[model samples]
Target chain A: MSLPTHTPVWRIKNSPEDSVVLDSSDEATFALTEEPVPSLEDGEMLVENVFISNDPAQRGWIQKGVLPERLYTAPVREGDIMATHSIARVLALKDSTDQRFKVNDFVYCMTAGWRRYAVIKTDPSACLPVMVPQNVSPTAALGLFGVPGFTAYYGLHDVLKFKEGQSLIVSAAAGAVGNVVVQYAKKVLKAKKVIAIVGSEEKCQWIKGLGADVALNYKSPTFAQDLVNATSDFVDAYFDSVSGVILDQVIPRIKQYGRIAACGAISGYNKDVGKPTMGATWIEVVTNRLTIQGFVILDFMFPKDGSNRVATEAFPSIAGALERGEITLDGTEDIVEVPFVDVPKVWGRLFTGANTGKLVTKLA
Target chain B: MSLPTHTPVWRIKNSPEDSVVLDSSDEATFALTEEPVPSLEDGEMLVENVFISNDPAQRGWIQKGVLPERLYTAPVREGDIMATHSIARVLALKDSTDQRFKVNDFVYCMTAGWRRYAVIKTDPSACLPVMVPQNVSPTAALGLFGVPGFTAYYGLHDVLKFKEGQSLIVSAAAGAVGNVVVQYAKKVLKAKKVIAIVGSEEKCQWIKGLGADVALNYKSPTFAQDLVNATSDFVDAYFDSVSGVILDQVIPRIKQYGRIAACGAISGYNKDVGKPTMGATWIEVVTNRLTIQGFVILDFMFPKDGSNRVATEAFPSIAGALERGEITLDGTEDIVEVPFVDVPKVWGRLFTGANTGKLVTKLA
Candidate 1:
């Protein structure tokens, strides 16, 4: 089958000094030019993106200085397109024997990320379930019902094994994964206290609205002390999204027999040679008998048991709670779904801690 | 029974700096001093020193700073004697019904460390034990068969969980714990390869005598490379007595899922507060999946399922092997078995690394 002529791709120019800039406004050197889509091969299907995911991890992938192999989702070389998540429709099928995909059907693909038009060489359902859930938005398939949600679930429920009546502290608690983590810890884990440590006061309140018992501003001068005092018992489980001074401080305060699931170190990605001064403070981990496990979500819910198994195992208990209004999403009260074209600008603003609610970029 | 008022006791002065002094001549500080002996109370037994154990850990206990609390086995209050291993004869008993003690029998008291006279309050039976073989001096019980020996055993056989045919690396391999650690790893644990990292070329030869596969002097400029080259499989277990530059290097080279029984950090003890920058390089712990557990011999072994259980469980097996002369401590063949009076001098020499072999101060 012939594919569309134009494919939208995002490119990173020079290494970003601190934050990733996606729009054409900044001095970022590279560009994701609209290129002519190649013809599909046998056993291949062409997918048109209906929703895309923007992750802080992308900051690591696009930056030239970051180790090339860290781009695990898809190998991104110089002049190649940046990678991210997107749910797309199978606009064309190259092989009749390809029983996995229909031409008009929708499928979810993670490796085939960011690009508007992709000539997927193999069946997408082989990686993640391709069957579209009725009533759930394609963007929801990329957000709450996707990798971010699974990461929050597995890290909290499995790795941490957080028990009831314990405090959970999350760093970068306003980001996509962080928001889901806060809600999961509070509602599903039945934590006595769920505290969100974010970069701004507004982000703190926004996370607090997402069923967090308290949201402490990590940017405040007294943030560390405030967190220490707020969670005086000290955290039973720490979900670290940002790894820097916050990690260094939080580690020393974790209670005996505490667990920490370190998913990302967003704080160090931009630093030239991010000498993260933070350490396990071995004395503390020993004295407290703490266990910290570093994990990538891809290691867990991928290849075989992807999101559906997690959603199936997870959603039953949470879905009823959600339907009963026991669990909630922050700023779900005032939803703001922006168009796909606004992604770069919205992503730029997201890092500034300006967005208050779930920021989903819609493509129809 | 009234305690003898003339029993000499040496008290560490109130001034932190005055408690420990490094001598320019001979380089040995007294392991124990002759001052007024400790007074006895109810339910306490006055134990006359039969043997005293000197460990590299004593250096840390007298260390001026770095959390002075870390320096003491028990708090060395203004007038209290420093505590350590003492195989003592019970001179006077406050209670005849105290089954933990018998008037003339010998018992090892941990709290009465490095002293000639100790009045231990607990049931003396509850303290650590050693049955002195008629041919082997009670002092040998302190060095070869007691705390140091137990430290080596627990560290290798328990903490690092040494498996037969695995590589083992022990720092300070000529010192008391290191000397015994290397022997046990090679002869008892049946380690395939045991690489001992020591201070001097002479000490390397000494460790070689202990049945080490190879002994490497860490002082060499090529120490890290030499260590890596020597241990082809990388270290399966790292028995760290010295946690300084060597450990900074070792932490990186540790094999995947390696175990570090961090018994002591003797390397950084001398430096004043924050003076010694211990480059931990803990990221290696995460990436390589290493487990570094710090332990005081007392803390590491005494509690339930701690080193005591390890000591009782492992000692007999190794002792049977040692009895057959399968394990021996004679690499350097330099032995400093001095009178109690020479302790201060020998201990001072210990810090300067002048005296070799286990310096066991003999007490009659």
Candidate 2:
């Protein structure tokens, strides 16, 4: 197979403002341009990017300066391909040295840039050969069988060690990670009560369809009272992705020995980096004996030995569930697929709550 | 052995204000009075209290009305004997039904009231027979080999699971639990560095003598900077007995996957029960991925099955250390032994930081 002669890529200019969409004057935040495809070296393969995963973490990565040592990520400089997880198809293999992947094979690359085509090392450590199971779409790989799915799996199973019949509250329940967390907590973990906090009535319905026992819109004026009423017996575990006010409200309601899986703080992502995000109080933590753990899925996926349990266990489990129709992406009507040029616009949908389920941009 | 005909007891009259001694106007916070000793009933024993343990948690228990459900202890109601740990000698046994304890035996009781003599249930579940090692003072049973020692043991070993070569920071390093935590972290766990935070220069010296690698007065103007300088690599585990600004400052300096053993929040104990204490931010907790656990030692000492690992393991370990001269309390000059009648006055010493070591009152 011949590789494309020219590939279009989105490059970061300036960071996005605290808004739903990049301002017109901040067009420099991201620019789309076409360039000649670079030649692949030995043990390299050329890939046609199919879908780019949009996540709240992207906001932290694109910021201009060095973040705190704790929140540190490789800075996404100007004119560089914005970093993301992407599903791609191997268009050409430069050498026959690597036998794990070949031409026409679909693969998932953690280092996939926001580009139409990428040159990825054929090293299995760099990318994995993705076998799209029957009846599961490639998009589902980015949602239910992807990073978000694995994050929820390891967080609830390993971090929180969520027990059967325990009550759980998930923040950002309609988003990529939260949706999967709600489903897994109820369907897989057998959680007694699954309360979901979302931003809109539509998201409440969306999360409810995903097997959430109770879904409350945080935007509702009765959000605080609704949370108290829903979790009268107190939650045994909390999966927090939006960690500002939601965390503050949930902290007091957590039962003694409750576990909190701190996945993301999207509510504070748009704020100035290093400025403290609100909601965590030591008083509640000490009084209630709560255990809070923050995690990044890559730590498990790319461990010191380079063996990824997510690929071996979480992905397979999610795939098997999908094949059996125990889990489905049927009601994900808001998974908007925008063209490659509109990557910036689609990425902004995450902050504005304009899109739901998994937001993926098609590059092919 | 004949029990005392009359016993002097301190009972709570009203709560205290901010002072080193209970205000005369609030003498109702506690009243010392002589009363006829109650005769022991079947399955009961009369004990002549030798030493009454004073702790900062007393402040929370003696608070006026119903505290928030989180900080609720059975309130030390007006005219009730203030509850505390005590070392007592069995003066008389009413019946021979329970064989675990007998007359003249020295035992430690969690239900020991603030009285010169107490009528205790001979039920093995309510009290444990204490074997005071030769050359080890009976008071040491309430300090180095008691609740504080066990708290430090389980917190670091089981809760935090602190390993050798890891760094640790301890708050309230001069208090009963903090003192034991510092010594155990250094002498037993072989931690790489042990940073102790206290309130005074005397406490700084006191904890240093207890094997802290570095000791800093949290009251010092440069305390925060001193903590950062002392723990350049960040702390792996924190044995926090004082949670307030110190907690706020130390949370950010915690390394990834750090553990915090929340033993007590003495700094917040004197404050209004329900009001939130400052210094713990969720950003660092989520960013650093820390685990914070609040613990009360009784939960471990008297677990649901009544089989205590503390009684079997920690007590023996501390006794062995004392017998081997590996641990000593000879230089604890700050252990002020106030008269039993002055219990109310001395109890306020914990909040004011005017006394140190194990503040005990002689009731014999």
Candidate 3:
């Protein structure tokens, strides 16, 4: 395949103050500019980007200050290429020493920044080959067979150890990661009941269609009482994506020895530093003997053992499920795709709860 | 053994409104009264109480209203005997089909109320035999080889799975459970460092004497910075007996994959019902990938399975350690004993941080 001499890439213009949703009057928070493609160096492979994932974590990456040092990747700063996971096709390879990926092969770039083309290292340590089964759509690789899918799988199966016949509750059940969590809990784990907590009636209906036994709109005036009534028997596990007052309400209803997977705290993503995020009261935790654990998907992908379970276990399982038509993308009606140039505006949809399914930008 | 015709017992005079520490103008929250000894029924055993344990949980048990249903034992009601654990001698037995205990044998009663004599069920389900080593003092059975020691052992070794060479932070390090936690973490677990967060200078020195590498007076104005300075490498595990703002400070300094055993929240014990207790922000939990679990010792003692690990593991291990003089009670200087009549007054010492070690009332 022939490649263009120049490719357009989005660079963060300035750090966001609170929320990543940029205002129209504010100078471009992310600026699109064309640059000459650099020649590939030894051990590097050039890729033609197909799809760039728009995740809720993008809000945290663009925050004004640097995040405190931790095990995960560092926050993106001004003048940096807006960081994202991208599905791309390898156009050319410079080094023959490493044979993990070859030219014209489709690959999943874990750290592919927002650009039309990404120059990634050919070493298996840097990227992995993504094989989309013949019977499945390519978009399945971006959704149910991707990082979001693996997060829901590992979080419930590995972290929470969700068992068959146990009841589960998921907050933000209509979002990308949460959608998969609800499905996997109901379909794969055979959970007795799957309750979905969402923001709007539309999201409630959407998640309900995806096998949620009960859907409660958190915006309803009687939501708290509704939650209590719905979970009269109490839930055995809670997959939390939205923390804050939602946690405060759900935690009291968690059964004794219930496990909580704290996957994301999107509610506090935009809050100022040093300010306490609203959370479940610790008194409930102690009295109920609850176990709450926070996790990041990256840990499973690049564990210390050098074994990538996602490639060996999750990907094959999810891909086979998609190929068999057990998991469908039909319910994800609000996955609005925008041109690469309009990435900044579409990115804001994540925080506004306007976009459904997996939000991704199309790049050719 | 002969039983008294009349037994003196402490019962709740009225539920505490704020603090269990009764004010001068207030009626006695716990009142000492004399009652006729009840005759033993079939399958019941009469016990002469020796040592009744005083725990911080006493404050919560005396609260005015009914607690919301959860895993923990409910509060003792007005006109009811205050509940506590005690070491007592079996004075007499009736219809003792199960041969777990005989007359004059010592046993640990999980439900021996605050009384001079208690009528207990002889069923193995009710109480278990307590074997005190010849070389170990009887007090060792009430302290290091008892509930406090078992809580520390199970929480660190089982719940937190604390490994050697890892750092630990313990709140209320001078109290009964906290004392054992610090000693076990330092001496048995061989932790790299043990940081003790206490309330007073006396407690600072006391816990330091118990082998705490660092003791920070939480009341110190510069305690937060002192914590940062002391734990330069960040803590790997925390045994939290006192939860409140202290959690807010320590949580931010926890290393990635840090574990927290939420044993107690003494700071909020006397707070008004329905008021929120301050706790570690959940954002840090997510960002740090931390695991926080709440536990009570009774769960381990009376687990659904008939196996009681506390009896088979903790008691024997702790008793052996005490017999070998590996664990000492020398620094526990504040175990001030008073007459049973002064129980209500001395009970206030717990909340006031005026007493240390195991605060037990002498009933014989």
**Which candidate number maximizes TM-score?**
3
Could you give the CAPRI-style class of model 3?
A: acceptable
User: Candidate 1 or 2, higher TM-score?
Assistant: 2
B245-323: candidate 2 lDDT, tens digit per residue: 6776888778987888887767655554223422234456766678777777777777778686876888887777766
Q: For candidate 1, lDDT tens digit of each residue in A1-364?
A: 5558887766555556555555576565346567778887787777887666666666555555433322344435556665666667888877658676687776777656556788776644422444324455556555566667777877888778878788888887777778888887888778898988887877777788788888888779898689768866677889887665677678656675577786776665545324434132334443344555655566556535444555466546545555666655435322345654555665555455665444555554
Q: What is the TM-score of chain B alone in each candidate?
A: 0.80, 0.89, 0.89
Best by DockQ: 3
- lDDT (CA) per prediction: 0.64, 0.76, 0.78
Per-residue lDDT of candidate 3, residues B218-302 (tens digit): 8899998999899888999999977667776787778998999998878767664223423324567877899989888888867
**Cα distance off (Å), candidate 1, residue A267:** 3.9
Give, for candidate 1 chain A, the lowest lDDT window spanning 10 residues: A272-281
lDDT of 2 at A115: 81
Q: What is the interface RMSD of each candidate, in Å?
A: 6.0, 5.2, 4.2
Chain A agreement with the truth for model 2, given as TM-score: 0.90
In CAPRI terms, model 2 is classed as acceptable
When sorted by TM-score, best at the front, the candidate numbers are: 3, 2, 1
DockQ of 1: 0.16
